[model samples]
Target: MIRRQREIDTPHISWPDKLAYSLPALSLAIIGIPVYVFLPKFYTDTIGLSMSTIGILLMAVRLFDAVTDPVIGYLSDRSAGRFGRRKPYIASGSVGLAISIIFLFKPPVLSGAMINIYFGFWLFALFFFWTLVAIPYESLGPEMTGDYHERTALFSMRDGFLIIGTLLAAGFPMLIDGIMNIMGKVATQRELFSFMAFIFAPLIVIFSFYCIYRIKEKYQQTGSDDLVKGFSAVLKNRPFLILISGYTISAVGSNLPATLILYYVEYVLKAQRAEGFLLIYFLTGIVFLPLWIVVSRKVGKKRAWIISMLINTGAFSGVFFLGPGDAMIYGVLVFFSGIGFGAGLALPSSIQADVIDYDQVLTGQRREGRYIGLWSIAKKLSAALGVGIGLVLLAKAGYQPNAEQPGSAVFMLRVLYALVPCICNILSIVIISFYPISEQAHAQIQREIGRL
Candidate 1:
């Protein structure tokens, strides 16, 4: 019976399936730029909104995000159709995300309270649909294959594509430059984002359909499908909470450097070389992803993640000393940071998959959506909080866009950009150390769940 159950839990996933599954993540990575890195800068530098106002607006957006993820997750878990439980959300949400990007990138001209209102409204719409598409899509990963290491292989492909997409997004300005040159004109940030939206619209549609048509959810939710029970089970699951907390804090650490990289390059380093630096950073991640996957396979995800955090903490600690005209030095540090970046990207979700399996063992139901949704909430909050903290801190330090900031401001930027993330990384290592779900432990949980 145990052997049969083990056989039932594990499914073979072909390479074609892995490639197809990875395509949607490319779209996700492209769209992520405006949300994670560019939007704050664009709104502040171009639209003339104060940094604090933008920070508050972002916090508000993420606060709204906090509410929607679990609600969507719950609905997704309860949802069923000819396509599958997860695919319907993926399709509809992708469409919604595409439309929202269009409006977000090209809002009608407004000023004063109206600009903030406009930004907040579209950001809310953008985040809502993003949650819709992302949560269900993430939930599908663990269900694709139950093999412990194979999950890392799948995400390696996913994040590899994600890095490629980010690189493309970064190059949009240059892409705009080439196109405008061909047409005998100039380029702008708004135009770059507009072009990106146009490109991503079709890509999102194509990939969403491809995944819906190709990838099928392998595990069916068994026993009671009660929503209340599902929520209770997830809430009561200690390991799941530990994993989310660790991932969330690590996300905050990850986001700070991202949120500040553009500023770091422009003001602190005083160079028009931010995009080049970002390319190196993401490209390094692409190169190191397979290595991190191998490390995870060898040492297990939790330990591998701790090692990644240590490496990143060391890298960020080095950044505390860099000043103007230190772009090359920063580039070397970013390369090491990207190694940690690669591990953080691939391992956490795979670890979450394992944690979800433990939840199955405890609750006798498959609740990947709820768990992923909650994880999404934490992820979003971390990004929002990172922005809020950075902007608020900088505002207090008298940060002004496109102008020479005071010495105190420069010090604040450098500290927030480097030190805060180091602290967060240290905290993440501590939190992750408590993660009890080892590969052997997950295998035992799978065995127990399979027996039921």
Candidate 2:
């Protein structure tokens, strides 16, 4: 019988290793923005579907995601490919994602029953491909480095570039319009999607392939194990369970403000150019992202996370008190909120990677796939829940898309935008406080595992 090798006190990863290993994560982050930020709006506005209908469709598709993520994770964990367990899936998933993204954006001219068919097929393909890409890519973080601080640094770089992708995704439509104006052509939403799909599809394929080529995995298994047992062992890991639970709830908090931003800008503030305001909101967070990394390094990840959450809570709370003409005040608040948003966006994965290390120390097996799978599941579930909440509240408030809004609807929008996220964010801080792994504790665990 071949026993798993005990950990050796390996030297810290050199800068070259960090850069090489981080590429896959950076690629995923860039590709992920389109799915998270634009897809909902695409279905509702561009595809001419009702918000509630799109919400239900997304919810059903995510139910399927809940099933697939863990299974994929388990399979990847137990895989013993010649290239490595993750590389095969990573490469295949990237290709699938590129194809699906093109299909998603460029719908054929179909009417009546064919329209429904198009929607269903496209939705299925999108979620299927996303799971394939996201689960394996997230698994790489924990597998790349066992050090706690180093994980934070790795995730910081990944998320920093993620913000770049988000900014491009957010800003691309406007940027394309400017270019089209110069070329004496009009740019519609369809035209914008076409342009982005054409540009980004090849980039996703190439960057993902580059990442697969550049990164190397150290973990390898030659023996097979029961999939059921592998999953059960993962479930029994307490630290991972706690972290996932907290993160799922925290995801709701993170998504609420973003989901409500357009409504707040258009209905409450009466801004015709609401996307510009949204861009400002996103850019504010991007600018503050590096500062959060520095602070996390100085004060430690958990405390830094808590501080960021409080700042966000305070900023979100300010919206509740705003009157109709408070756009400037709201803008200022959004800037402050981004300070907290940057922390929330960047730190959780690093913390999750730490928990994975704890599990490896206890079980003598590297189960990054299982942990990443659960993490993906938690994030998707929370996003689904957040969208569900947004739809429910919109319905309750009698919000009709593209209709002249009523005072009551606008009032309710403000309250939901401010009160719900503030309360949820405060709760998230409390939950994160209960997370037991300090940076110091994680470093000591790495040392202990090295001596094992």
Candidate 3:
């Protein structure tokens, strides 16, 4: 037993190495915010595409992206070459990502239909390469460390950098626009998107190359040899199922607030501007990540995560009662709300790494890419579902964009923004309560794997 345990031990990764390894997350966040948050608006308002066409195009492409994740995951697991399993895809995908971003944001003059076609093709290409980069990249975390707490710490760095990336991505364009306003000049959204794409393209290249060269993949000699049986076994892993489901439910809760924040500030609070409060919300997540890490260390990851969810659930509940001119009160609520946000961002992926470890033992093979791929699918589906549900509710309540909505519409918007997420969080907390992999169970699983 001792000898078997010794056979699987991995070296401790230093803080600098973890940070360097996580730089790609920064670029990932930088790219993601623009695509999800801003691109639809850009296409509709700037490129002359109708909202309906843009909406359908986005839905089709994202569903296609979700479908392709597992295939990519299976291929990534089976891949072997001089560049190693993860890096070749990471390096090549970075290039594809850069080219696609440039073309998508900097298109030539085209009619609405032509623009939709253009966006669709490039968006598909972008998601394809994004899958290439993200799946294997995320798979590398658990492989970097064998210690459970270190996995949490590692992803804390990851989620921290992701928040920083989000802040930078969100802040830069707004900063640019603010500067233009002060100078009494107007810059179109196209130019802003073009500028961002140009700047981040090279940064993505630099970070991807840095990660590929600097962050070493721990060598694994055995992988699942049969694709059909392996994929089936992965689906059957009970912990993975629970983790993905709870995480998906949690993602819906997280996404609703994001999708509705502007509307909430604009209508419910009657605030002419609330970007400062939004920044406070995101910045708090980065700041509180270390504290959450400490909490996870003391209470265990699952418990810590539940506590965070409860905090968010309780904090968001107050927003349902807020009214016009409640901006200051809302800001305070967002500040407290962000503590949970930080923990939500950091803990789940680390917990996921632990589950991957459990799977490695059960199957006697490493299938991190496959697992992370399915996880990615859950996230995409949740975001899609959340947005769809929120919009349908708003539409049913007679909400109209840029027009004064009736009392019923405003009340419905508040409910969707505040109460719906609270309910999702409660449901997630309930689902996760049944998760069975405690620290002792994980250690036993490791011992069992070592014996194999």
Error of 3 at 274 (Å): 3.1
Candidate 1 vs candidate 2: the lDDT winner is: 1
Candidate numbers, best TM-score first, in rank order: 3, 2, 1
Q: Candidate 2 regions off by >4 Å?
A: 1-57, 188-191, 222-225, 400-408
Query: Model 2: per-residue lDDT, tens digit, 1-452?
Result: 11333232333666666665555554566556666677778766777766776667767887889888988887888777567777888788878888887887887766656766787787788778767777877786677767666667777767766767666666777788899999999987777778877888777678767767876776766235577777787788776776677667778866776787778787887666666666666677777877877898899888988898889888888888886678888888877877776678778888888887787777767777888887877887787677779768877888888998877787778777788887877777777778888877887888866655
Q: How far is 442's C-alpha from truth in model 1 (Å)?
A: 1.6
- TM per candidate comes to 0.88, 0.89, 0.94
lDDT of each: 0.82, 0.74, 0.83
Q: Candidate 1 residues 264-379, lDDT tens each?
A: 87888887868788777888889998998889889998999899899989998999899888888988998898887888888888888888888767766677889987887787
Over 4 Å off, model 1? 1-8, 35-59, 103-123, 187-194, 220-229, 270-272, 398-405
Pairs of residues at least 3 apart in sequence or in different chains that clash in candidate 2: none
Error of 1 at 330 (Å): 2.1
Q: Stretches of candidate 3 above 4 Å error?
A: 1-8, 112-114, 178-186, 224-227
Q: Pick by TM-score: which candidate is best?
A: 3
Backbone clash numbers for all candidates listed? 0, 0, 0
Model 3 lowest lDDT segment of ten: 1-10
lDDT of 3: 0.83
lDDT of 3 at 261: 82
Residues forming the 10-long window of minimal summed lDDT in candidate 2: 1-10
The local lDDT score (0 to 100) that residue 6 gets in candidate 1 is 23
